[model samples]
Every structure is written in structure tokens, then in C-alpha cells.
Target: MTSTLQPVTALTLDLDDTLWPVRPTLIAAEKVLAEWLRANAPSTAQNTPPAAMLALRAEVAAEHPHWAHDLSAIRLETIRRALRKHGDDPALAELAFDVFFEARHAVTLYDDVLPGLERLASRYPLIAVSNGNAELHRVGLERFFAGSVSARLHGVAKPDPSIFQAACAAAKAPPHRVLHLGDDLDTDVAGALAAGLHAGWICRPDGAHADAAPRAGAHRFATLLDVADALGV
Candidate 1:
């Protein structure tokens, strides 16, 4: 165990880029959505390309600031807007979103994730805390987690202390006794610190924050295996 690290009774983990490379997963899911749209809503598909769909999603998000924490809502609205703009049935958004969501859950986890999660889960009650809509059960990783706290369900996202507190509550641990691990510096490390929880920043080589220097009062690691080793799990 690292002497410098604080003792924690439970752990909160980030999903997307921490356990898996989210870009590829999202890209593949978008492709699946496009294909489904072409088959079911040909007019909408013909009118909206991938770039246009992204713009539509952004436009919807800007129009609905209150729904910022709910990505699923934004995505569904985007699909509906596309269908409506193209003279297609907006109700088909539900089925289109379902297709996209299923593809989104088809993630390829990092090599270190399984072993690291096994080690950590054996030692601590792991709670998934995510801003994304990826479901643990769909991702086939629910068994490793005691519970999950999501922005959609909680009405707040990370960088807001409430979500982290919710995760701590789910673990039945006080903020001081709950360590939160994630890849994003702002949402994960700083957010956990702000919430009075220990922070572990897992900076994978290919991550956006990979070149970031270590911050004071936050643990930095290259992989989940490194985090497990540091925690002596």
C-alpha cells in the first residue's frame, strides 16, 4: 500500500474512457444509427450525414440547457429533429435511439480493466459514477459494481459535487472514505477532490489528458492495473 495515499472504504469509478476507449465505441454506434436510419427513415438519413447529425445534436443541446446532463435525451431529440426536418415520422426516434444505445454498449474494455476490477472489487465495494448513458448491465460489467450513479438519474453531472456524493451514498461510505477514479482531470480528479473524496486519475497513453502533469493531492496512474498496484489490492 502507498503510505501517502489515504485509506478508503469504497470506490467510485468512471466508465467511458477510463475502462475503454470511448471514441471508437461512439463512432461505431453512430455508424449503426446511420445504417438503421437509412433502412427505416430513408428521407431523414438522406438529409443528415454524420457531420450534420452532430451539428443537430449540438443545436438541440444548446436549445435545452437543462438537459445537458442527459446525453440520451439530447441524442433522441437530435434524431427526432432530423426526422421532422426531412418529412419523416419523428416517433421513429425511439427505435433509432434504441439501435444506437445497443451499439453504444458494445464496448471493448482496456486490457487491464478486468484484472484490475477483479482486484479492486475484492477489496472494496465499487460504485460506477458516470456522466454518460452507458449502462453497466449492458456493458457486461455490472457484476463488478455494487451500484451505479448516473447524471441522467441523479439530475447532475460530475464537476458538480452532488453526483459524487450520490456515489458515496450508494457505497454507504462517507466522502472521506470513498475514492473516485476516472480519466478526465476536471470531472474526475478535481471533482472528487472538490467533493472531499480521494482522487485517482488514470491517464492512459491515448487519452486526451495523457500529457497532463500530476496534480497535488491527486494520485496519477497510467492504467487500472497501476491503480490496483498502488492501492495494494
Candidate 2:
């Protein structure tokens, strides 16, 4: 007998690399943000190119080992330190954040995203869980997600149960009735499954590369359309 589609009341989705392609979009967004910062916030822009920011991130990782668990805090501290190192110009720092925020909203969703989300949203509450900044849900994705919890606000990230619990709490769904989807096995899939939610993997290739298996057991789809179909939405 064919299994019936379980009634899912909520969805907890991972942001980066799941709903949208991460590397190219982020890299392009960063480039745009850098140019904007250079024009509007020269002081902060002078020293912090992408490479510099990455290196500082590495240094920050070593300095505060605990931050690896919650990267949002690490991101905040990194921005603050970078601002201080650049003569502590608060206005310029604000401009930098503004630039980055605008660029982030400029993202292009996967072709399947809008339709898939619309179909899912018609039936269930949808929320996003990410290790990114708390503003992830507020940045023009309001049409899709009904709620969100990020590592910034929760003080914990994926692979840890707190973030997922918070998302389920926000959606008022028991873990078993919620479907959580993401691109990471160790973090998103494994973590959500461990927390009792059904988990799936969105495994689209960004460029020329491909992810190898070991992503079995989890439902896998190359596009959100496939996911929507799998859910019988």
C-alpha cells in the first residue's frame, strides 16, 4: 500500500544554499556591497575587502572557540571589531551594514522557490532557521515565511537542538509534524532529524561541482518543485 502524506502543520527551512544558491549569489552580493561601502563608507571599506574579512573571521574563530557554535555572535563581534579597527566611525559602519543588507535582498531565488513556497504556504505555516543574522526573515522574504529563528537571536545554531526547538515553538508545531529542509547533512538534515522532525536535503549544484552521497536516508531533491511534489502539495 502507498503511504499517505502526513499532515504537516509547519516547515522549518534553512536559508543559505537551500532556498537559493549560496556561493554565486553571496559572492556577487558581496562585490556589490563592497563597491557601495567604498562609495558611502570609505573608512570601513579601506581595510576590509572580502579576503580581509575572511582572514579576520579565521582569527576570530581562533580567539573565541565558543563562537563556532553560534556564528551570528561571531559575525556581530567581527563587524564591531572591524569598525573599531577602522577608527570607530559609527556612521560609516552603519552604511556598510545598509549596503550589505540591500545587497542581500537582491538575491535571486531558485526557479522553484516562489511557486513551491506559495503552494506550501497555502496549507502550512513556514518558518526559516539559520545560523545567519536575525534579519534573515525580515529582508523581503516576508511573503514566504510566517516566522523565523536565527542563531543571532537564539544564541545557538543548527546541529544544536535549541534553534530547531525555537522554530518549532514559534510555529506551534510538534517536531514530528514539521518538515525541515536544508543543504547541509551534518547541520540541517541530521540536526532536524535528531530533533524529531522529518528532514530533507536540497542538493542543487551551484556551478560545476556536485555533492557526493552519504546524504541518503534523507529525502533529496534537486529543486523545491520536487519537494513540493513529494509533500503532495
Candidate No. with top lDDT: 1
Cα lDDT tens digits, model 2, 84-166, are 77875654555566556556666677878888888878877899998765355445578878888887667777989878889
TM-score of candidate 1 to 2 decimals: 0.98
- Model 1 residue pairs with clashes: none
- The digit string of per-residue lDDT tens for model 1 on 9-69 reads 8999999999998999999999999999999999999999999998999999999999989
Q: How does model 2 fare in lDDT?
A: 0.74
On the 0 to 100 scale, the lDDT of residue 13 in model 2 is 92
lDDT of 1 at 48: 100
Question: What lDDT would candidate 1 get against the real structure?
Answer: 0.93
Cα error, candidate 2, residue 227 (Å):
1.6
Q: Relative to the true structure, how large is the alpha-carbon lDDT of every model?
A: 0.93, 0.74
Task: Give stretches of model 1 more than 4 Å off.
Answer: none
